[model samples]
Target: ILTTLPRYPIPSDILTKQHVVHVQISKLPTDGVGLQLLELNDDFQFVMSELRQYYDEIKKLKPADEKAKRLHQNETFEGCCCLYAHFSENGMREFRRGIITGQSNGLAMVQDADFPWIGLVELRNLYQIPRHLVGIRQTCVYGVFGGFNMKTENERTLWDGICREMCRPGVRNVATFHRSAERIDYSGRK
Candidate 1:
């Protein structure tokens, strides 16, 4: 499991999902015996402003001409692309940052933060992320819910359920675990 720590001045090693980030967390490995998150050093507001700005910029991008689009599509199918794709989770569909890990027949295998399973997405659902955004690292780190004894079948089942719920789309409160319980909660609006 991974735990997030609040570091002062935002260490250089810490990477954010967006270029302009107000709050950053340092991810570290945990022994699975402590709390899932640590308290932040300062009060911070978690907002989707950066994400909204990203989508706005994406919307402004002009569609590539047919020839160029075809070339890019071919590259993607060959697993030579790290691009954005429309992924569906918990009945919610949205574009997510992913890379083409593998391909078979007409489907491309995609890996992204929204789900643990590798998604098989059609070529038409994939889009080349704008060049500027392609370099940005993923905002959240993947971690399993701790304190479960996987040796037992029952515990394993429970652990899997917890992970499924926590990773469900539109759940912003997972990131807020580092904040105090009394703090105001914000919905992860798209």
Candidate 2:
């Protein structure tokens, strides 16, 4: 019935059908008792590692595109993250193999702040005032293979980490816009 009605595909990182390996430590992992490390299979670990690597790659892109003549060289401009659009199966596979393929530059995903399952799309923009800077902002959707599993508090923490990693001293600014219970506007800066 749901399928018969108008429906849109959603992207999800953590799906109920897909088994995810999680490790829990009540106290701390000690060598004898506290140090019990949960073993994650190579496949799961590898997938997680790949996701992290992709995240890193997305963070590294300059805020502005090369074609911008006036603001291309400016260094103080900040970039924002937005959603791209849904990709094909091939594109999804390429995303999964981002480390080896290095073909993430062209792939697009949906990114809607209102939706829980959104993909990311990156764009280039310009800014000037304190300093001229050019860089790309990202657009994101939940993605077909992975869905966000973070809780409200966890989401904040993850956002903090992403901003922290994206912004570095002397580097260009990275801006993030989030709208949920409260709207948060931040320029990835100290």
Candidate 3:
């Protein structure tokens, strides 16, 4: 698939490069299941409307006060987003979101002007890479605003199990509460 593009997709190398799309896939090789999500540039605003709407939900989860707004007042995010996906029990393909979430409590609002993820756009340009690709799996990312924290042993242990189990063959049940940041196979939902 990547051959159609100008280069083979390398996640680390591509991130180092401009305005390129980062597509992460979570796959269960034994089950022939996979979810693919593209991280686009801010210039692609049309694709980000749903993800941007999550800011409203986040605000509602907080107290009804100005302080709550200030906590995540930075209304702009430099990264891309894919909000929803369709699932089929019959014969079809799926390209969805793969999110690793942490415990909910306290505020984890990040507003970095020069987020490292944003620099990836220019790096891709340097290598004459295309804007679209299937990025290498990024199992661990830190210090980024919307990334997981791999500091504690307990958290690390928890994440290890989650990742392994999610990729297992019989794990057909995929669920997520972050509607805008994830894609849930809701076919069974009443």
Candidate 4:
């Protein structure tokens, strides 16, 4: 999809069927916790379908021949994560992997406020802001492959930690990386 759309941002990660199978069969032993892949609920599925339609429109407007002229940036200006289409398989894996890949890497998925994901086709009117995966704002999905499980009872630990930082003056983009994943304050920063 990116070959056609320009500067698409990645929004969230997903667990693929193959990944689940690989973990169930090949991955080494850990804490012996059973794995659980997130199921797309009605709302998420609808949002995904709508997002795809928006991208399809972009493909229609921009021809594949124009690929070279595209801006060609696949990451966010914040550098916390790479931006991608919300529908791409690679994007989904990146979201999951960003949190679980490293020995202590883990990212807390947070709900986005005033998320610009709805009506992406219309959003294109604001062409200045491309709706890539990072545009999704809210990431509520989860898939435990090896060991990136949410340590606290509520997954909002990271969200809470970053809440104050987010509300601070002039803090436009706020994110916690996998390396600092453990720093998410389950204690509720508010």
Largest TM-score belongs to which candidate?
Answer: 1
RMSD of 4: 17.7
Off by over 4 Å in 3: 1-119, 122-151, 179-190
The clash count of every prediction, one per candidate, is 0, 43, 10, 12
Give the Cα error of residue 94 in candidate 2, in Å: 18
Q: Which scores greater on lDDT, model 1 or model 3?
A: 1
Q: Write the per-residue lDDT of candidate 1 for residues 32-126, one digit (tens) a residue.
A: 21221212212221212433455566566667642233224445454444344354445644555566667766567666522222456776666
Tens digits of per-residue lDDT, candidate 4, 12-38, equal: 332112212111111211122111122
RMSD of each: 11.5, 17.9, 19.3, 17.7
In model 4, which regions exceed 4 Å deviation? 1-40, 63-76, 79-190
Best by lDDT: 1
lDDT of each: 0.40, 0.26, 0.27, 0.27
Model 3 clash number: 10
Candidate 2 Cα outliers beyond 4 Å, as residue runs? 1-40, 65-190
Candidate scoring better on lDDT of 1 and 2: 1
